[model samples]
Target: MFSKLVNPKSIAVIGASHNPAKIGYVVLKNLVSHNFKGDVYPVNPKGGEILGYRVYKNVEDLPEVDLAVITLPAELTLKVFEDTAKKAKFIIPIAGGFGETGKKGKEMEKYILEKAREHNARIVGPNTVGIYIPSTGVNTALVVPERSRFPGDGDIAFITQSGALGLLTMDSVSLYNVGFSAFINLGNRVDVNENELLEYFGKDEKSKVIIMYIESFKDGKEFMKIASQVTRKKPVVVLKAGRTSRGGKAASLHTGALGGNDAVADGAFKQVGVIRAYDEVELVDYARALAYGKPIMGDRIAVVTSAGGVGVVTTDYIESKEHGIGMKMASLDEKTKRKIKDEVVPFASVENPIDMTAQASDDDYDGVLEALQSDPNVDAILVYALFQTPLISEKLVDIITKWHRKGSKPLIVGSIGSNFTMKMAAKFEENKVPVYMSIERAVKAIKVLRIRGKYIERWENE
Candidate 1:
């Protein structure tokens, strides 16, 4: 059903315009800038040229295309949809004021869905920012390139109900060296909904992990059924909005989504093996861990940090039961402890969280990580490589990267600072090492991996 939407052979912009402020103009610019390989047809009554492509005066005159992007008002979209319904296989209407507006808007949404069924065409939204597939260079998003950034081609497929929030969240995580296979914005959800897309992306080869920011499930039971099946193969993380009664009312007004009981939804999420994220940070953190880090097979974790304070707090997080994902500090082998203590200064802590102290050098981390990776008792390792120290250099990035690439076990790093620290963090991520800004986030990421691993382990044993 989403074949054309995923990889359209040809696209037609129905309301193509020359105005820089118009959404149509930005859509065309994105396609051209992203280097879309397919043919592009601009449809406008003006019958002129836009970005070097000739504009068709009418949709009827243009050849049948795989996708049609309607960038007009809700009322105007219906007239254009009537023309493109027979010509295009997939339609995207990027306009607001549809079902979210009230009774008149709901009627319009009903009409569009009826027409879509009649023509055997699928619609993405009547009020959406549209989709972005990095691999195919298909970017129909409404974001200004100057203000926001888009991720490169990667393993995560992100789906969201709110377009603006989706784009903003995508931008927020873009700097973390994570890439996206696709970005789908389901605006009012006139026709295409989350359950169908979840099933579609489940089979998508490029999407190793599927993440969503959902305001409400169009069909709760249907979603649970599909998500349960998908979770067996790959990780699915969701940040369900409208958890509070007041928040639910706001969600309805924002996107016409009817809110449900949060307690019931939480139970359903766990039943289906869906990892629930409470905020935007957890959403991306879990995704980064699942997408890049190795599967954690057990709950025992070893922490190696230069700062004693960081290691102490991280220990607290590991043993904390409030988060519900149980984990504990690994007891290192006597030989492993002796080796690490010998490699570093004699005073360096060789216990669970091996605090090498600020005086420890890059070589110290390199050797200690190797010891931890070889220890049979350690299921995962969290290292805090604070760059502000006198002995730690940028070379620590390469050392950590080499250890991570070995894939000996699940590894995550925590480095909290401003400019220089974030720079190294990005480098750590570029080398495929998951680095968190704080100890709490890194610990949470470890739990996420543990949850996903337990699911896989259960399925395998069954």
Candidate 2:
């Protein structure tokens, strides 16, 4: 069912329009313009051509397609679903004011759901932005691709509940050239929810890492079971919303989910080996680390930095036990220390948080990184590649990228600066080394990887 939703060869746009401002028109336009190699049939009450496709007067008159996307008012969506469900392989409703509204809206959503079951047609959403599969060029989002470009194909599969937020994250992620394999928003999931998609995408060949932005779990026990099984295979990172009473109210209003106690959610996630992210930034950070970088074997992390301040701050993050994450600054073995001393300047610190000073060049980073990679005591490598250093040019990106591709040890790069540095940072991302703008942010990603390592250990024991 999920495969049909993501891989439809022909799709009928039930509310397709020519108007540029309306969502129905925008979704059709994005799908058509974004190069979806499917036949697009536009249906509207008024029989007229929309974007050159002859519009069918009603859903009943539409030709059979692999998917039907409904962009009508909440009250009108059900009747359309009834007419099209039997003919279409999948149906997606793209409107809110359903279960999230109130008791009356719930009744309406229930009716639409019954029609789906009656026809045995799978549903994607009743209030979603739509599904995005860049590999197949299927983008069902209500927004256009001009202002917010779709992500290129990559190994991460992201799912979200909020339509607006999902689009924003996709647009932001694209700016850094970090792409996604597929993105689906489970809006007011009348029938299709995260569980089905999780199991389907868990085995997806293109998706190496799975990420989610969930307001609430539809089936808590089932989710926990599936999550535990999936995490042993690949990393699953989530950003659960509505932690506070005020936020809980908003979340409930947003998705009709009874946001429960935050502490229980946190504990359940940890037990299942699922990593939790607090915000959008953390969500993307964890996703990037899991998708591109190697598993953080242990919390004994070594920091090599051209900036002493960056080294100190990052070391603090590693030592601090935030949320019971027990991490330590790695102790460099003598062999590693001797190699670092011989390669770096004599004034450079040979201990943990190895500061090579501002005068450090690309050669200094190359030497220190090699030593850390060889040390059995150092489980992970964090390099603060301050691009401001005169001698450190574009060459540093390749050096870090090389170690990452070699797959001997996990190497994380940290470089914080203005736009100039961001361009340099994108180079590292392009090569898949996973560089971050801040030491704290960089260390947070490493923490998530370490947490996954611990839970994977439990799986191996079992």
Candidate 3:
């Protein structure tokens, strides 16, 4: 089911063009720019050159390709698909005015479904921006390359019902350099839905985490069934939209989603082990943590900080009732205290929020982390290093990265500082430790790890 669409060996842009204004130009340009390692053919009746490639008059004139991207009018897209369905294994229509509009649109969608079945072909969307697969050099997004630069390849395969959400997430976190295995916009999903995608990505070797922004599921029960199995292999994070007071109507218009009862959806997601993200930040944060950090084996957390106040705030959030994360501030064992006291300054605290204060050296942090690694009570570590400290050196990056690769427990870096600190934070991130500017954000990432751990524990018990 996923062969040609996700990993096509060759592609034909049905409405490929030389004009800078058209979607066809962007599609063909992106395919060529991204250095798609497969055969790319530009299909257009105008028969002109686009980005150094000759434009074929039609699919019949071009060599058979695995996939075809039709960027024509809604009605015209159908006619093109009717011809290409016999040749192309997969097709994507990047035009709107489908079922989301009205009755006529629905009829168009129905015809697409019938053609797909008749030809044993598949369609990605009737109204979609497109998908991005970085590893395979498949950039099907409509945005011009000059305006938008993509994130490098990583493990999180993110799919959004709203292409805008996917683009916004990519743009906002460009500095953090959050990478992905793929980015898909499933607008007005005429054929391919979450069920199909989850199954494909669940077994995907490159995808360690799968994140999504879904307004509604075409088949809620089927999604749950597949999601339960998928979550058992890799983490699945969802930002289910339209759960608010006006969510139903808003969702209907946005993606034609039903926006079913919020409570039922919540319970179903929980039962199936899907992590629900409340907002955009959590959506990215949860995915980053799950992808970078290991699952927490327990709720006990070791908070290490250069500032005492931030550590207290972080601990408070973890235990606070409103947060509802089943977490406990860890009590350091005798050996951990002894090691910290020996390496750290005399004034530093060796307990839970191991406050190594301003004068603490890089070794002090590493010593404590090293001690915590062996401790039975600790299951996670939260680091808050304020880089303004004179003694905080680049050596800390090595220590953080070293322990993160240990993979025994989840490790998160929480810092609140200026531009210089962000630069320092990027070092930890490059080595696979997620860094957050706020104490709340750091704790939220830890909370996600704990939540994932609890779900895993439940599965083990079952």
Which stretches of candidate 2 lie above 4 Å from their native place?
144-146, 243-260, 322-326, 344-347
lDDT of 2 by residue, 129-159 (tens): 8898888878778775577777788888998
Expressed as tens digits, the lDDT of each residue in 167-250 for candidate 3 is 878767666677888888888998888788988899999999999899988899999999999999999999998854445446
Question: What is the C-alpha lDDT profile of model 1 across 235-291, one tens digit per residue?
Answer: 999999885454544665734344435877888988899998988888888988898
Best by TM-score: 1
Provide TM-scores for the models. 0.94, 0.92, 0.93
Which portions of model 1 show Cα errors greater than 4 Å?
243-260, 323-326
Ranking of candidates on lDDT, top first? 1, 3, 2
How far residue 77's Cα lies from its native spot in candidate 1, in Å, is: 0.6
lDDT of 2: 0.82
Pairwise TM-score winner, candidates 2 and 3: 3
The residue pairs that clash in candidate 3, if any, are: none
Off by over 4 Å in 3: 244-260, 323-326
Best by lDDT: 1
TM-score of 1: 0.94
